[model samples]
Target: MAKLKSLMSCAANRLQQASGLDQTEARIEIRALMQHSLGGVNHAWLIAHGDDTVTDALRVRFESLLARRIQGEPVAHILGRREFYGRDFAVTPDTLIPRPDTEILVETALDRIPPDQACEILDMGTGTGAIGITLALERPHAQVTILDYSEAALAIARENARQLSAHNVAALHSDWFSAVQGQRFDLIVSNPPYVEADDPHLQQGDLRFEPITALASGTDGLDDIRRIVAHAPMHLKPSGWLIIEHGYNQGEAVRSIFSGHYFANVHTVQDLAGHDRVTLGQLT
Candidate 1:
């Protein structure tokens, strides 16, 4: 018992010093590692009885995970789960992390779609199944189709749908609208790759771990957004809504794209941070 505590304390201290995280974060991560090693036991149970000596095998496993986390790996990837829209989702390197800004797009879409009406929604580049699955779960009457270019990402999205019990969602492997030709949607939403290829932020933090194709959009970062706007009218019902998340500086450009396409009620929504993170337009 005493030996296990000593080993954990030592590892936590080393991780704290090397990673520069605060003491609280370091302790939480180390305890999470211990809990993971104990067959996914609750943190409270582990804290109450963790002093009990663990097997040598468990100690080795804990150390391996700690080492990996110290190397700048995202904890969500390490734990294989990310929480989105108040739901836990399985995630992997193949899909992008579900960001909070995306919730605005979801909320806006829900507001625009009539609950009593059976609607079809198209979520382009639906990584991790966050947007489409959330919509399906929120509005059971709605049928959602999620499209992604990467087969691996689609696999992850499918798993998330099954895990979330979002049976109304249909996952497809498509580059934009290729797989759903001749189908029309009442609402079309996307958070496509909007980061410019030359953005320095891409080389820092968790962005460094995400796939480039899921982050960068040509040289201007608006290439995918442009393509989506140009093609959305064809797939949308006459009055369908098109909502999208983009960089804060992209609101004007996105609004301009919608204006050029003759969309009505084109406007931008600010995220919690007060940045213009989402833009919406109604097909005229």
Candidate 2:
């Protein structure tokens, strides 16, 4: 059996060569693969045993997962979960992988919600229940409705809610507002599909593996965003808020959609990248 450190180093180098990840990122991915293949052990365990020898079974499982990573599969797909807002939420190809930038949407909405009140929130396109579940967990008094068009995605969302103990939320199947026709919410948040259908990025990297419907909208990528904004006024309680995530370059268009829909306090929030990433507005 190879030493754990040697095995990790070899796998990391191979992954880096295959995927173009830098040394540090390659090592991190290898570490995550190790922790998972070793049956969900924590990072400290890997640190404590860095000098240990790898068991044959562990070597086999780790190498198998590493091979998948080398083939460009997302680590979250291999591990079956992704961390968002500091929580590991279950994920699958059926749902969009929870990304760090989406946390900005969560934080922006979380800051707007009063902690002690029974705020009603609707998370449209809640793929893994990351947004709605995090909101419900953060503001326990808040009741969040997690809606998705895909039943498979909604199943993942529901499972994530239960696994995370986010009891204050409900997962509903809907194509946008189809299932919630007249239901008004104190806040409506969405990380909708905003990538243009023909965008070349869709053919590369992790995008290659994610569901297309969760990533692309219409030709300009604003079709779903427009639909969400156009129908938001009916679902939002007067004086309530609407927050949505979009492509960094599409902020101005999203803000215009909100403004044209008569949403007041319309504005866009930039993620850490200084790119406009989230747009929010309030109902008059």
TM-score of each: 0.88, 0.97
- Compared with the true structure, the alpha-carbon lDDT of candidate 1 equals 0.89
Tens-place lDDT digits, model 2, residues 169-194? 98889999999998999999999999
lDDT of 2 at 132: 94
Query: What TM-score does prediction 2 earn?
Result: 0.97
**In candidate 1, what are the lDDT values of residues 84-175, reduced to their tens digit?**
88998888999898877788988988898777779999999998989999999999999999999999999999999998899899999999
Q: What is the lDDT of residue 4 in candidate 2?
A: 84
In model 2, the runs with Cα more than 4 Å from the true position are none
Candidate 2 lDDT score relative to the true structure: 0.93
